[model samples]
Target: MEYSKKTRSSPRTLDLNHIENTLSIILSQVEEPLPTITEIAEQLKINRRVLSRHFPVLCHKIVTKRRHYMRMSHLAAIEQCCQEIKEAIVSLQQSGEYPSESRVCELISNPGYFRYQQVRLLYKQELQSTLSSL
Candidate 1:
């Protein structure tokens, strides 16, 4: 009987912020133009052969083309949206309620960040509108 070979687990987890900061540093080091794969991995201390495996988790692609490097932009958009949500939540604190649940439901059903194409759109509009009417 032949003994089966065991494979070792590779590097599994990396801090998201660390990876983004490394990418920023790598991008900055180049003069306006983007750096090559080797340069990015070198700055980030990530192995070029396996770096692609880690990126999809931390950075969702905003754009991609066959010849161009993939563009990831979801983080900024999500972060900005979250900040606006927090502000709306704070405003609601003074009042007893806000129409958040309904609006959120609508948003969930439709699957879009903007509600009626308004920036920082949130479900609590009904609550706010109700308060204004009183």
Candidate 2:
């Protein structure tokens, strides 16, 4: 399973929420058949290995009869992330940094956001666990 050096050089600027939301929806549809990683990566225009390397939670999110697929892990990791996001929203509201609820909403809705990797960094235990699997 040796990886090429190019896989190591990609910039970590992917939209985390887009990944999160996409995975969330994929997992939410329990009864429907889902696309393979190859399909997903192709649709996203990202390298399959790169996407897999960047987000190992996809492993936890898959499930299959033959053990090749993944299923979302029913754990506190996602819930914890949502809590952090909520708290950050509250802080932003109190600071009044961005005027208008719609503006704040727009900021939050934009996937190209700052501090996302920092937030990911904050959940080191969860991230580390997934990275170890990778």
Candidate 3:
């Protein structure tokens, strides 16, 4: 956040670039392993209340963006897990092995419990569809 060591020419001089950079730093820290605003202000050598006063909009934006990003990340991970589970199920079926929950778990590395349930449901549906087509 402290972009430079040089003192500002005037205490009242509002450097928009400096403020923007500081806001960026603040937002970047909003993810997991977040630092407190007081710590951030101390690191930037500014008063916490003053920083909040100057960047209320940026603070709100950071909170919103962080929440959205976290949700997206979580959804992506869940989708990936589901895909992996499906692939594992197909592989097990091809190998003439039953795709039981334990077998599916063994086929995939560090499979999640909920994902395994989803995989079981998907495998059953696929088997039922295949049988109905026969």
- RMSD (Å) of each candidate, 1 decimal: 13.5, 21.2, 9.5
Please provide, for model 1 over 1-134, each residue's C-alpha lDDT reduced to its tens digit, 9 standing for 90 to 100: 98769777786686767776765554444233355555667866777645566564322221122114322334456546555555555555455555364443333323355443343444345447556776
On a 0 to 1 TM-score scale, where does candidate 1 land against the true structure? 0.30
Predicted structure with the largest lDDT when compared to the true one: 3
Score each candidate by Cα lDDT. 0.50, 0.53, 0.68
Q: Rank the candidates by TM-score, best first.
A: 3, 2, 1
Q: For model 2, state the Cα shift of residue 59 in Å.
A: 3.1
TM-score for each of the candidates: 0.30, 0.36, 0.56
Candidate 3 residues 1-134, lDDT tens each?
Answer: 66888876776555657866977876766456345557767877777777678887876776677667777877676667667667876787778786676777776665674544555576577656544654
Model 2 regions lying over 4 Å from their true place? 1-12, 63-134
Question: Whole-model lDDT for model 3 versus the true structure?
Answer: 0.68
Regions more than 4 Å wrong, model 1 = 4-6, 29-33, 53-134
Clashing pairs in 3: none
